[model samples]
Target: MRLEQADPKRLVAESYRIEGITDGECRSIFIDWALSLPVGVDARQAIKRLLAEYRGTAPDHPMTAVLRAGLHKAPQARRRGGARGRRI
Candidate 1:
C-alpha cells in the first residue's frame, strides 16, 4: 500500500509481509510493483523509504537486496528507433 507521500507499490509491501518468503518470489513481486508505478515516479526514493521502514525488522530478508538493487538502479532512457516511426 502507498504510505504518506511515498506511493510505494502495495505488492512490494505485501511481499515483505510474507513469512518465509523466497528471493525469487519477492523478485517477481518486485517486477510487478515496478511495472505498476506511474510514469515519472521516483523509484529510488520510494525504495529508500521502504528500506528504511523495514531496516531493523527484516535485515536478512531477500527483499532487502531487491530493494537495494531498485535503489541503486540508474534511470533507464527510453530506446527509440525500433522501426515504429520517423525515417532518417
Candidate 2:
C-alpha cells in the first residue's frame, strides 16, 4: 500500500482507540513511530509508512527509544546470517 493512500493521523487515532490507550500514551506511540524510520525519511513519511504497514491494527505497545533501535536493526538483521551462514 502507498503512503498517500492512507490517513496516518486517523489511522493512529483509531488504532489507539481500539487498543484502549490513553491520550498521552497514544501521542508517545505516534511520536516513536514517527522517529523510527530510515535516515532520509521525515516524521510524516515515517508515520505514513507505519500506517501502511499497520493498517487496521493496533501497535503492540507504546513507542519507545528501544522500538526505534529495533527498527534500525531490522535491515541489518535481514542481511546477516546465523553461525552457519543461514539467513535468520
Choose the strongest candidate by TM-score.
1
Q: What lDDT tens digits, residue by residue, belong to model 1 across residues 1-88?
A: 2464354447766877899999899898888877877777677777777788886788888988888887664888875776774556
| Candidate 1 accuracy as lDDT | 0.76
1-88: candidate 2 lDDT, tens digit per residue? 3553333345444444554555566666555545544455555445545544564354454532223333453343454456767734
* Candidate 2 minimal-lDDT segment of 10 residues: 61-70
**lDDT per model, in order?**
0.76, 0.47
Residue 75 CA error for candidate 2 (Å)?
A: 35
Q: Give the range of the ten consecutive residues with the poorest summed lDDT in model 1.
A: 1-10
Candidate 1: where is the Cα deviation over 4 Å? Answer: 1-9, 74-88
- The residue-level lDDT of candidate 1 at 20 comes to 92
Q: How displaced is residue 67 in candidate 2, in Å?
A: 16
Tell me the lDDT of model 2 at 79: 44
Residue pairs with backbone atoms closer than 3 Å in model 2 (clashes)? none
Number of backbone-clashing residue pairs for each candidate, in the order shown: 1, 0
